[model samples]
Target: MSRRPADRQRARVYAWEDRHVAPHGGDLLPFTAMQPMVNAIWAELGLRYPPAVEPLPRQARRLQADANRLRLRVPEQLPSWVLLHELAHALSSTHDGASDGHGPCFMGLYLQLLERYLRLPMAQLAPSLAEAGITWDPAAKPVFLDAAPAR
Candidate 1:
């Protein structure tokens, strides 16, 4: 069966997370444990408010821009990168616009936040996205302030 792009991205992020998580001794990293980090990323992006993260009843991750929150399928066991991915969506809506989807603009925002705010290296994330066939704009600039929304 063919996999959705998001599923592919999730698998890649999860694998990378697994390799890095070994030092923590296999304990599950809960969303609460990662909230501060997510908040920091949100603030670093100069968002007016931190995105709200909550568990969705269904087994699928969703971004609710109008509500200014992320509806996660499994909040308790969310991987750090996945949280960052959702945060990118939140920031995109806040700065870009509520109508933006997963396009070049979104991809650029996602990469910038992941690298600058979440501290994931481009050397690591870029290859992963390439392998997953997710195209992004290398020249896409990240928002550094709330002065204006990005295009």
Candidate 2:
């Protein structure tokens, strides 16, 4: 089957991460600490978990991609919620076999998982996301998935 737009976009993000984000201090982030959380979310959502976590290069700016894994830029400073946001993307992509494009479904599921796993309310999560330059608006354009064409 042909790859979906979301899949391609996800790949692009991964590429960006690999080339620009991984080379810096990205490895110092709490990757191990985040694994269990990611797995838990994946199990709950019934998604295939990625085999491993790898660091993307560091020059990554607004856009980045990692190796079929999570793709995120390393901010000069990162907030705790940033981890959760990327985790949500990873889980959603794995479970659905397609990127949800950070849309309402993705955000709704993410918020639920965040509350359950992190014990943080949506209100609390929003500010942290905003602080990290992550968008809280579900209607915002997603980086990965897009609407499929009508047959």
Candidate 3:
């Protein structure tokens, strides 16, 4: 089966994770654990799955146009699931009206995709979701805040 764009992108990110992130003793559990979830989601949705997994930064941002085109910036510090979640945002076509923000609907859809694709219970995923620092608020503007200054 042909690979989906999101899955291909994910694989690229995973390679980055192994090279840059893993050598530094970075934890890959979050990224490694989500594959089955993604595959499950693909099966449910009947979308083509990719071979590689990419680990996206936590503070990544995605730009979307009405035509369903997306530009993603993968953060080095972000977990792979978070990156996939943002990709999910694009795949599901959950965009706010005119403004670029992750609103309640977008977040809800993200959660639904996570559940369906990741085969994870909502409760099990909540902590990971919280760790990824994703918030759902339609009125809020999307911003890429700098990581906290190192101590």
Candidate 4:
């Protein structure tokens, strides 16, 4: 569960990722449409008891809060990749039974979500993680009782 290397490697691997993409496929998400998309994903992943969604205030560049809530900088732009990244944190923590880690479990679930929901190929994603010395266990995955709702 070493943090630094995995964090650096995750960034390296996703460096090509755009922060935003059209939710329905096209260019980046338009400003007016961003909040709904963000909230939608937040609710979708929150599972049966989805947490409350909050607006990120203007002053904060970062935030500290419990896993029971999702916060977004609404009315401002948000990238799809950023949304997925934060969602992975919540999903991994919830599934892995650990509060936090950038280790295999975290990145594995991150890549899983990307591959599953975004249709990114793991053939390209997994190796770069290994090459960068990130221990990624493919078994690190979230449990779904049935098909996940279409994003």
Candidate 5:
């Protein structure tokens, strides 16, 4: 007898994303709290403009640079790391005009934001990225500004 499709197929599995604990040992930050933080960080980073945070129809988080918006799945818990990644996209888009999408410019911007603003250690971020099947070059240096303007 032939096996049914369901029987033949393996169970569906989703990719594992890195879960980060808040400084106080809490889970992800709610949208209300996170949005303001994004705005402040954007200003602190001296970006030309701040992106608005909006609800995304789907469960994935993404940055829409042209619109200057960050779309995130609503009513879903989002790790701080994930939000930081999206902000990196915003920074890359605004500051980097030379490198193409997700190229060296993007990586440098992301790493700089992660280290400078988020205070995330390379020790932690690198491994988390590797587990997600993304390879990051540790030698990539972040572009520094002459003087970061105060918000």
Candidate 6:
């Protein structure tokens, strides 16, 4: 799994996100605030079930997500952009995403999630993805991207 392109290149992914998407979706939230937000993203993306929002794995040292849970570091790193990245993981896990993990499909969903949730313009996102060497499909967006998140 770690040998996969996206997994191996995850540093580049973080770098890409840092340079391009930072300061865009960094809305900080507490644990109480994040559950509803996570559920909302699940519903918006049409995922069958949202993962449990839990505390960071102590060893994770970073945001983590899977089919069953979205583990986060509380107090310090609770940002929307971080949620978007992990949500993409949760979404991908539902679609048999284990094969590629953080590969194209996952990153594609992350980009679309960014587009939908953060309103980040693809005009800006597209070029940076290339520059960052993070491959993404423009058309890989879900239908929910066209609609606004629940209010």
TM-score of each: 0.54, 0.45, 0.34, 0.58, 0.52, 0.74
lDDT tens digits, residues 1-151, model 4? Answer: 6442324445543443432223322344455665466457656655554334355566755542223123333324445555556556665554323433555666777777777667777887676566666666687754332224666
Off by over 4 Å in 5: 1-26, 58-76, 94-99, 122-151
- lDDT by residue (55-147, candidate 5, tens digit) is 655534453222223333333455565566566555544342222234444455566666775676767766655565544445543232322
Separate clash counts for every candidate: 0, 16, 14, 2, 0, 0
Top model number, lDDT: 6
Candidate 6 accuracy as TM-score: 0.74
Q: What is the lDDT of residue 141 in candidate 4?
A: 55
Better of 3 and 5 by lDDT: 5
Over 4 Å off, model 2: 1-29, 43-51, 63-78, 94-97, 122-151
Q: What residue runs in model 1 are displaced by over 4 Å at the alpha carbon?
A: 1-28, 58-74, 94-97, 117-119, 123-133, 139-151
lDDT of 1 by residue, 44-120 (tens): 65554565656545544463112223333334665455555566556545432342445555566767766664566
Candidate 1 whole-model C-alpha lDDT, 0 to 1: 0.53
| Residue pairs in collision within model 6 | none
Ranking by TM-score: 6, 4, 1, 5, 2, 3
User: lDDT for each of the candidates?
Assistant: 0.53, 0.48, 0.41, 0.52, 0.49, 0.66
Best by TM-score: 6
Our tally of clashes for model 1 stands at 0
Please, what are the lDDT tens digits per residue for candidate 3 over residues 4-68? 33332333333442443334333333444544644554456554532234445444356211112
lDDT of 3 at 78: 39
RMSD of each predicted structure: 7.0, 9.8, 15.3, 7.4, 11.2, 6.3
- Alpha carbon lDDT at 73, candidate 2: 32
Off by over 4 Å in 4: 1-27, 30-46, 62-75, 94-98, 143-151
Against the correct fold, how does model 1 do in TM-score? 0.54
Q: Please report how far candidate 5 places residue 116 from its true position, in Å.
A: 2.5
